[model samples]
Target: MDIEQIRKRAQEIWEAEGRPEGQHERHWQQAEQELSGGGELPQTSSPAHHSATTIPEGRGKKKSDAVPSLGGEPGGFQPGELASKKK
Candidate 1:
């Protein structure tokens, strides 16, 4: 994508992230994904634009500490948790 488009998207992400620090890479990737319409990105917050981490923006590790679920409970979880049978 062009620099301007990417820049705009990145800025949006950064803003959604509460203007956090040191998350340039993450923000950039997220912006790219959204702009490119890559679809739901794993380990990424939905366009709801909220980071799982509640530690505020500029502390450290700007992205949410919570694990991003494609469609399950948020936060840490085991693989087997997705098992779909009860035998």
Candidate 2:
């Protein structure tokens, strides 16, 4: 991948998203994805959706819910269990 092309595309993405702060990595990844012909990035309807902390309605889970396991287990393991198992 061309660094210059990626930089230009990232700048375009940054400008298109109103130049929000602290999103350099995301913009760079998106630019790379586009330049590599992976697929077009999904367009957001509003600039507010660009905030990293803004979880969309109906998409977030309650804190009480079990986080799903990567191994396709029924009930997920506790937070520290995965690392313990690895060791």
Candidate 2 structure lDDT:
0.72
Question: TM-scores, in order shown?
Answer: 0.45, 0.49
Q: Rate the local accuracy (lDDT) of all candidates.
A: 0.65, 0.72
Best by TM-score: 2
Q: Clashes in candidate 1: how many?
A: 1
- The residue ranges of model 2 lying beyond 4 angstroms of the native Cα positions read 42-47, 50-87
Tell me the tens digit of each residue's lDDT in model 2 across 1-87: 999999998888888877878888888888888899987763432356556668798776665356544445544455557655654
**Highest-scoring model, lDDT:** 2
lDDT of 2 at 11: 88
Please write out the lDDT profile of model 1 over residues 3-78, one tens digit for every residue. Answer: 7999988888777656767788887887788778889753434433454645676687554456443434444344
